[model samples]
Target chain A: MRSNTFKTLLLGAVFLGAGAVAASAGTLDDVKAKGFVQCGVNGAGLAGFGAPDDAGNWKGLDVDACRAVAAAVFGDPSKVKYTGLSAKERFTALQSKEIDMLARNSTNTMSRDTQLGITFTGVNYYDGQGFMVKKALGVSSAKDLNGASVCVQSGTTTELNLADYFKSNGMTFNAVVFEKQEEADAAYDAGRCDAYTTDASGLYSIRLKMTNPDDSIVLPEIISKEPLGPAVRQGDDQWESIVRWSHYAMLIAEEFGVTQANVDEMKSSENPEVQRLLGVGEGVDFGTPIGLTKDWAYNIIKGVGNYGESFERNVGEGSPLKIARGLNALWTKGGLQYAPPIR
Target chain B: MTLRDKTADETPRSWVRAVLYDATIRGWVFQGLVLLALILFAVWVVHNTAANLRAANIPFGFDFLNMRAGFDISQKPIDYTLDSSHAQAFKVGLLNTIIVSVLGIILATIIGFVVGISRLSRNWLLARAATVYIETLRNVPLLLQLLFWYKAVLSVLPGPRQGYVLPFSANLSNRGLTMPRPIPGEGFEIVMWSVPVAVALAWAIARWAKNRQAATGQSFPVFRASLGIVVGLPVVLFVVLGAPLSFEIPELKGFNFAGGMVVHPELIAMLLGISLYTATFIAETVRAGILAVSTGQSEAAFSLGLRPRQTMRLIVVPQAMRVIIPPLTSQYLNLTKNSSLALAIGYPDLVAVFAGSTLNITGHAIEVIAITMAVYLALSLITAALMNWFNARVALVER
Candidate 1:
């Protein structure tokens, strides 16, 4: 009788374990079954990062990241729906499976990776917190911002960095915070703040959209490191790899000097690495390892180009933001972007 | 109202049938089943929530409150710094919420009463003006109104460099209303203590006068005497202590003011939004309440030779208060909840600082939201309890 009871208990435990496994399915399958990728992008209107343009097209570096992932997964960048999320709502949206991945220029902080039920795929944009002030204010350095009222967006790393920078330097300042980036911009334009602070890249974005772009200038002080990147919900290695490699594919294409226009012709390149990345003659199918088609990297390049191309069109010199590819250039250049070999 | 009533003969046909088929017993059984189902549903919810959290690998616990809130609140109500723990931030948020809600309530009540009475004025212009004010303020959404006020404040005022100097050396600018900081000298505490002591003395005098009036059928000038004690003692102490206070004028140092007390524009916009929008509802409530009291009460008071103002004070308002207190409690609760819209304009209320900023920092959405909801719920309950006690006091004795 005792042995029979123990066997029944063991059988019940096995059924429970099987039930748990069936519930937490992979996100890639969900995206494929749904026929599109739901990506969380910036809703707080940080323009060149992730905001919809006047023509209703979502055009930004972060938006391109989502499109690249969708292109890799479904072989079409347009097979993606964007959910614009604010800084405060992004992680909860990701954790609750409201989106496939968050590409809203979120910083990959240690606490967020280990604690927030989400993991950063890779750094898509390297940023640091900086200040923007009116040129009329005559503030040359951030050090002169003592006793200043600085407008900043809430629920961001900028506020903490501002406080730390001020406190450690033995200065006092007032922070006028707003929930949305546009509101902070409006306040700064309206002269409610002496300086506006955000990620340095975002400062360029903010300056471009200000009422008088010529009146304001971004200050030359980077207060804190903010490795802005795309992130996915934790505990799904298959989905994580698919998203992580989508970014690496962009960098590798950039490293090989592969432009979107030349991708079709370069499919026949003699270089083994280029052939491996574009899946032409490398003999090995790179996409199968990450559960995609053989032309996964090729689709991303064709859809959103390499990282440099996307950056130039959205926020770099090709666009109005005019930001230089300082830290975001390929590893062959004197920049930080590096990707492992595809083969 | 007992379970068994007289002249009911059907249940006694059989002891078994009676126990099984009696109305009270059947009611109890069905209610018990409903209670069981509710309990089971609650248990299922808790079990599923835990299971889902475990499956997603999201930690669901209150331990996050002990973590450092590495974010900075724009308006710190207490001594919260960037290095403070999330628990301390929660306290700062709670205190800020209380400060705004209390100030908004007091301001809204004063305006509501004035407008409510104005809407019923004998003069046509006053009543029509009050009506227009109510219609305009109530029709606009509170969020839009907040944005309007905040944007207006930012646009209307000049920057700190070109701020308008108001009376008493206060500076009015887009940043805020900056006034001189009051530095307390060594003996300012003695003068401060005298004010509260005078209030206690006034309370004692009022009690003694009330008893004398009850025994001798004579009323005393309690209001004037208590007002004197409260104000006069403070003034006398100030003179005796040689008024040990100094004012430090704010100077344009770097980019803004230094050595000043600043009232942030975000708080101003939030206070204005809650007060103006809530006052209209309160005005309507007061108007309805005054109309609720029967005209016969006023007629009876006039029949007793009371004048119009005396009749209103003695009969109409007292009767109207019973109707007003309940809805007024609702408006108070609404005001407290509406203050959470402070998040839109970036006032560091409990929701903005704790649930919005700290939640973003710690990524503990569940715990942060739960704590914020509990704080609002507790605030509402406390307000309701106080209003209920007042409601009971003014409730009809019905002797």
Candidate 2:
């Protein structure tokens, strides 16, 4: 398929293009020298995750993840430049150091983490593969989808999960696989498939973009775990730690009930953890290990807001997707999103 | 002769320069140097790549092909499952590529010949229509055409629930065209064997008829008789065997048709796009081949009181074929290579399934890409070899 093969050749071209290789080590230094942190994003445009807006500004949950890293690095969320990449190009681009960070709504699987010459940071969004179908189809549960035709994107865990799920459940379904999510979406919209499947969060956003969002319903059953997150190149401990904790900073900010508007006010609080996270007066300097300033977390909070705020604005109740913060809520709220102590 | 003698006599003084002045020796030395450089470059590239991969810690190996592919290919020419090894998955992909390429080549050649001849038609409408078809198809990108056929035309057809009924109770839908599977019964083998017997009988009859015409200066209706024998033998045997055949027509079960042969829309679009696009180029080649055949040959036949149709069939086409076969081989190779674009429309061809999906799941880019490139190379070489054999058959034998 040109969708993926074209990307392989494109990556090979970039790989073979003389002198295009970036410095393998010291990405932080390189990013600093260039004065902008380059982040590769989803080129197929997963809206509410990594698609650009009408003004050509990248605005999505995944986009904010990169901005959060940039704020941690440069104390300015606007200092990041974005490169839209396909599923095929994302890993190769990261390995070649073509981008400092990758926030492409990718799943963090064991094979991807260990073998692809890159390491995923903390998960920005906890997701699972789910199905969406037209409301008139009368299909309510995944168990009832015995002989359904499901449109899914190829070359991803989604495809594998679809197969495994069907086999284990003793069901048979026709899979209409496309190399790109957009193609699957079109196929589903054209009534070529009985159901369209992707990450549950993606289903929400994709449904929001459909001609009539209210006509379809996201099935309640989750089929496969999809831990969507950002990643950095392997072999760079400093850069890896910095990106890892950037995600935690957003969660910790939410755990403490802080917001972008109230971040400065919360800086003066007496709680030792909050004071330390914000680098308040006489608090511990936790950013030294990652080679960032003490106010790195503070800058992230101030620039992009906390994880909950970003979630609401980009993909949650405040946005058109209106996805519930199920597993993405803070550990205090009994969700799975738990961060390490800043101290 | 005097200058040559003087030069030969003076050669002893410049014998050191004479060795360099020998063109054959100079050419051999230069070729050897070039070969050495190429070998060295290849060695260096291999070494450098191994070292880079080692540095990156991305283990590269072919052992992973034996592992489970763990994915479903939407379309396959052969039976495949998720648990099939990557090697089997690759075989399915290769077969899919072969089927599409073979069909595309056959369809393109047929259409190309007709359109190519129509381009020279005296009728204004036919000539203009052929010109329009060639211009429009060749100018547009094949990828766009494939997408248009897939997404806009085929995929937008009625869904499975509202599928259109075709002859023999087959169904056509956005899913695909499902045809009835023929179920052969008792004595079917005997009827099947009669087909070859009929073909052999037809061949012998044609030979005898040709010899008779040559010896007696007369003609036989060899083509019609051959066609009749081939068709008549199968029917007579099948009837004598009590019509021992039935069809298992596809019927809508739940989500899709069952007990039938289904051809996915992905393959249909690929075949259509590849054949239509390549036909334009083949048509141009056919036209050039026809023009290359001398007009004097046809004129001579016409002067002998041969009809125009007979002149074209007996005299002009045979000569034109000699010119057409060589370039036509290149068009065949192009169609095969272009089939790699199958993944765009979700046709599980070689590149899409093995190189694209399998590589991604395995995370073994070096091995995957190397194998894919080698397969394409082998396929192209094989196509060229077959065409070369065909070309040799048509080549003129001279005194």
Candidate 3:
């Protein structure tokens, strides 16, 4: 009687464990079956990256990348779902499969990728650490900052960079740390710190928040390199490839003169490279190997435009940020943005 | 033939008795199996972590602790730099947490005791004011209070160029509250050591006077004598050492204060938020503890010709402490844990430095998080152990 009872309990436990394994596997397969993509983004903070409109519609450089991926897979840019996450919760949200891809303005670092068990596909924005001080301080350069108090956001690469910069210069300075960017900005504005330090792009966003934007000037010095990119979970090669190719497609489109407005017109061109990119004639099998539609690159360019177009529209000369495309420009244009050939 | 049959029957009875007698051994074997299973599970987890780390091409070691932290901390209690190792950075973070918690606890206790006493006061306005204070602070989230203090209060202060002058050569500005810093000379060390010695002697004298009164039923002016010794001895040492301390007053220079010790506004806001929020809960605990003692006890003491203050001191406080101590210890632990919120305001607490920046730089999330959690757990356990010893001393003794 005892042996029979033990056998029954063992069978029940085995069945429950198998059920759990099957359920998890089923979820992954379900995601693959869905043609569209779900990408997480930061909502309505920094301009040129992620910001919301008066109607609450999100748009930015990162948001465009998510749309590009959605267009590549489902042939519909609107198929993407944007999950807005805070800094503290972003990693856990991605790890738990709440979002298939995180294309937010997340910094690409060894710890975030390897330690957090996430993979950064490629760099989207090349940034550097810089400081913004009040113009009245009469400080033209970061080297002048000796024993100056700096306001910085906590839990970011900027904090470490700040320490390294000050110590390397053998200068002693007080740091006023804040968890949120807004709080740090507020502190900086109130003169809690003599200067505010963060990513160059972040310094621009913060400067815009100042009541008198002209009063604060970002110093000429760039402290450390910050390569921002989209990240996906490990062990998901299919998803990673899709995200990577979408970004490359934009770069290739720009090299080939494909803008959102002119993509349809470019379809009739006789050029061999354009023919292959639009999936018009021969070598149309590139998208098939990646499980995408034949006109994947076409949909991407039409939906989100080329890389240069996206940059100019969001954060470049046309936007409030007015960020110059210095290192972010194409390699042909003496910039670092080069992609491997699609074919 | 009958004797042979009885011997065979005894064999069956012996087998049944053996089974019943071995039950204790069986129970012990079951418990041992459970312990072994737990140990094996832990080992398996460690093995998996090691394997995963190897596969990811990451090193599994604490060598990173000696590497430069490279991150700036805002309110380090000790001298620290980015050139310092990860270990030194952690020490700086831990010290900042300790500084905030210790200061918060002292302030909270004083506020709590006064508010608690006022809650039971005969005056209506005093009781109402205390009630309002407790209700307003305790209801709000601690994080919001921290934000309000940092943003709404401290951040609104004028810049150093337009510093607000307060009494006693103090200046309030967005930079921080700058006050006179006392510079200690060579002889100051000797005077400092003498003060503590005088305090110890006074404590010894107080104990001697109490024992004499208990034995001979005679009173001594212990309070007056102890106070005189503790204060007078410290003063005499300072004078004998030729008053080796001098004040370095802060002076405005260019756009900032040049001299004196400046307390950063982040530290001030964190302390204010922590103390005010914790004090409300502590006040409630104090009130409940005092109420736990029966009114009859106080009335009985009064009938014996003891004054109200004397009755409260000898009877009520001692009994009330029995109820108050356990909850007060938990409040202290909560305050310590809540110090992690210092990260929110960039105060460079343990979480902000070690678990945060170091974890990012090293990419060893699992190890860093495990270490941080272990540190907090150890702190909580130590506090609990200390409180338990105190509680045992004050526990009711029954025959």
lDDT of 3: 0.79
User: What is candidate 2's lDDT per residue for A1-343, written digit by digit as tens?
Assistant: 4555656666554434434233356888888899999999998888889998889898999999999989999999999999988675677777656788999989999999988778899888999999999887888888888878888887788888989998999988888777777878887887778889888988887887777888899999998899999998777888888888988999999988778999989988998889888888764788876788999999999999999999999998887778888898888988889998876
Which parts of model 3 have CA positions greater than 4 angstroms off?
Answer: A1-31, A34-36, A83-99, A107-119, A233-239, B1-30, B49-59, B165-170, B180-183, B246-255
TM-score of each: 0.92, 0.93, 0.88
* lDDT of model 3 at position B41: 73
Cα-based lDDT at residue A210, candidate 1: 83
Q: What is the TM-score of chain A alone in each candidate?
A: 0.91, 0.93, 0.89
lDDT of 1 by residue, B1-399 (tens): 444443555455555666776889999999999999999977765666667667777778888888877666667757977788989989988998998999999999999999998998999999999999999999998889988998888788888889999998899987788899899997999888988899999999999998998899787888899999999988888888898999999888877787768788888888888898899998998999899988889888899998998798868888899889999999999999888878777787887778767877777666666677788899999999999999999887777
Q: For candidate 3, what is the TM-score? A: 0.88
User: In model 1 chain B, where is the ten-residue run with the lowest total lDDT?
Assistant: B1-10
Q: Write the per-residue lDDT of candidate 3 for residues A1-343, one digit (tens) a residue.
A: 1121232233223322322221123323445577556777874367778877668777788888888888987788878778776454455456545677887788898767776657898888999999999999999999988878888876678887888888789877777766567767877887788999988987897799898999999999999999988988776676678788899989989998988999999999887778788898765657877667789899999888999999998999988899999999999999999999866
Could you give candidate 2's per-residue lDDT for residues B298-346 as a string of tens digits? Answer: 9999999999988988888888888999999999999999999887887
lDDT of 3 by residue, B1-399 (tens): 443344566797766665556778778888999999999977766766565444334457777889877777766667876678989988887787788888998999899989988988889999999999999999999988987887765657888878899887889987788999899987898888888898899899989988999999788888899889888987898898889999999998655777787887878888899999999989999999899999999999999999998899888998988989999999989998888877676677787777666765665555666677788898789878988999899866657
**Which candidate ranks first by DockQ, i.e. highest?**
2
Q: Deviation in angstroms for B82 in model 1?
A: 2.0
- Rank order by DockQ, top first? 2, 1, 3
Comparison by lDDT, 1 against 2, better one:
2
Q: lDDT by residue for model 1 over A296-328, one digit each (tens)? A: 999999999999999899989888888888888
